[model samples]
Target: MPEHSRQALSDYAVAHTTKPDSIFDDIARDAQTTPSAGMMSGRTVGYFLNTLVAITGAQRVLEIGTFVGYSALMMATALPEDGELITLDVSEEFTSIARKHWARHPDGHKIKLILGPATETLDTLEPQFDVVFIDADKDNYPEYYEKSLNLLSPKGIIVVDNVFQGGRVLQQDVPDDQRSASTRAVQRLNEIVQNDERVNNVMITERDGLLLIRRRDAHLA
Candidate 1:
């Protein structure tokens, strides 16, 4: 697509998509105060996650990253009254800010933030998550994907963010060794999901990239 055409469609999408509630707008603005504010999840990804929670009737959610809680709050808002979401992150600096925002939302009571490497923290939990969203360290995506499977419920779904690595996965001109770790890791993940017969997956072209997966026997697509 040409640059002007792309921008026009993007503008149309933005104009048609529902805006976040005023409270969420506040959280987004506060997220900008961080040095890595650009790392925050965009509106499209956030709304998609919220829809997933509602569609799955998910009572238990596990979030692998909690950058200022934009995504966490999105999912939390869609959860039922008795629903629970346990989000893992290693940065107290960011999660502290997340906590503040979560407190401002009514459904925020459903979220729990655990501070530690998710690789270690993931082991302590039971395999009961109805929905799992992974958006943490790029290099550790492979490890996270495996662990997420172990914790997933029979009818659960997995949503992965940044699967495209800003479209680096397709640069065949660059040798594997020379490419960045994130790019290489994302390539490997896409391959892993493609080859796995135990599940079915689709790569959504929204945002950076969103990979939605489910057990072959899962009720939802």
Candidate 2:
């Protein structure tokens, strides 16, 4: 792709994909008031996540980050009537906005928010979730991935957001010890997932990047 067309390509792709309904617009509008508004997962990832739930027929889902609930609601829409999603976040302030919007939709009942540090919250969760999404603090990516892997059901998929770390990992490789903490964790995650004999993976380059992984020989314990 030409340099000029790079951004245009992304716009074109998002335009062609399933457009989010007006409720998402409302959520986005509310989130815009915050400094970290940019962290809200946009329609590209949200739409893809929705589709993943639909196709996988996932009955239960786990999300490590719930930024204003954009992605959580997207996945919830694709779930069956009896399905459920459990989302974790540390901020009541940010998630207060999420709660307002979740209540606006009928699928809101499908979502349950756990307000606490994700690492601690992960320890309390039982395994066998059909899908686990990690999108929280970059410095803890490796730890999150390890715990998420164990929480995932056999044949379940783990979808990691921001794995590219805004193209930082694309630069010339550096010794792991020399990289910044956040960068090192993100890079190490990509490396570990790619080489792990226990799972198969693919990295999709769209809106940052998304890493999708699943066990090669799945067995839920």
lDDT of 2 by residue, 1-221 (tens): 67569789889988898878899999999889988988999888999999999999999999999989999999999999999999999999999999999998989999999999999999999887998889999889888999999988888999999987877886546776677787778988999998889899999988889999999987553
Estimated TM-score per prediction? 0.95, 0.94
TM-score of 2: 0.94
Clashing pairs in 1: none
Summing lDDT over every window of 10 consecutive residues in candidate 1, give the lowest-scoring window: 6-15
Give the alpha carbon lDDT tens digit for every residue of 1-221 in model 1: 67578668766776777798887788788888889987888677888999999999999999999989999999999999999999999999999888998887889999999999999999999878999999999999989999999899989999999998877888768987899998988888989999998889999977678999999977653
- Go through the candidates in order and give each one's C-alpha lDDT: 0.90, 0.91
* Clash count per candidate: 0, 0
List CA RMSD, all candidates.
1.8, 1.9
Best by lDDT: 2
Model 1 compared with the native: what TM-score? 0.95
Q: What is the lDDT of residue 186 in candidate 2?
A: 90
